[model samples]
Target: MTPLYQVSDSPAVVSKKYFSRRELMPSQNSSVWQIQSGSVRTMTYLDDGTIVTLGIWGAGDIVGSALSTIEPHIIECLSAVEAVALPLDRQNKMVEALAAHVEQAEELMVIRSYRTVDSMLLKLLGWLAKRFGRTVDNGQLIDLRLTNQDVAEILCSTRVTVSRVLTQFEDQGIIQRLPLHRIVLCNQETLRRAG
Candidate 1:
């Protein structure tokens, strides 16, 4: 697949760089960064200081000031991240990339809003596999490390519930944890029909 924002000779894009884990990228009002490798999560705290996971973006994803007016937001690396710090002025110029970002974000919101835990988790895995995973012998391997807490925040559920559902999935041979804490979908059909 073509990267959303490739390191181009075009004057509109420049300053491609890497970001370490937990490192802060440009803030909400700053220039947008297009993911070239790895993943990033942009989030904000509630008045109660609770952390919210706004979005998880991998290669080919574009994020930052152009995408949202999300205030009090922080962009942190979930893994070692490589991205192009796109010029803010050119943000609206990349119509296709912007549309992809908006569509993925909305899809995530709808998937996470499912009433049942099984439905939510299953849909999330399905979407993640499609968006981030690569093909493997058994199934798609989502190479990102999504912890219980991360799942909890995305699904608006408790960590314990996330853990329970994950364990259940593993027991049922629907999913498995791999090295680097990556998740592998063992049964694509089962996940698709779970909800």
Candidate 2:
């Protein structure tokens, strides 16, 4: 990772106050930094007519891909958000980092393709278990704030189907749905087996 100061255009300025949600793009050669201080929703529009729910970026996760020969932005914030904006030069370095990151993300997508819809859900649960799980007294809880609609988009299924699958998971005690966009993973091993 590049040093934050080395990449910052204005190293002297750092805001303590959280930024509310907004969209941003690099100005000329500028790079924008978005830090999710807490849970926030996001939607990304692909070049195709399809839209993807990028889910929530928990605290300490960074958004914005700064590196690409062609402008690296294709994602947008879908709700009121909080983040930090950085200069373009620093963003360029971050883009280099993102290149490697994209490879891993793509690998995960490939894994998602090999399975049936039910398997996909289970795989997704497993992936989230590692990437975003928070240990609770009972089990690991996935911190991503996703609706069945969001899961449908990600899984390339209808919302109704996704909801049914989630219901099945709930019935099997594989997961627990909390109010306000939280999912509790009650049994990751069962989820893995189901997947």
If scored against the real structure, what TM-score would every candidate get? 0.51, 0.47
Q: In model 1, which regions exceed 4 Å deviation?
A: 1-93
TM-score of 2: 0.47
How would you encode candidate 1's per-residue C-alpha lDDT over 1-195 as one tens digit per residue? Answer: 444443557866577788898888875344678899999997765434656678888998877755664456578999999988765544445655675667567567656656678778887888888788898988889898888899889989999998899899999899988876689888658646632
Clashing pairs in 2: 20-81, 21-80, 21-81, 30-88, 31-87, 31-88, 33-84, 33-86, 67-95
For residues 1-195, what per-residue lDDT tens digits would candidate 2 score against the true structure?
Answer: 555433434545533335444554232334544555544544443333344444456556554544322222344444555666555454446555765565456435543563467767876776677677888876778888888888888888889987888889789788888887677778647645533
Worst 10 residues of 1 by lDDT: 87-96
Best by lDDT: 1
Cα distance off (Å), candidate 2, residue 182: 1.4
| Residue 112 displacement (Å), model 2 | 2.9
Off by more than 4 A, model 2:
1-96, 191-195
RMSD of every prediction: 13.2, 13.5
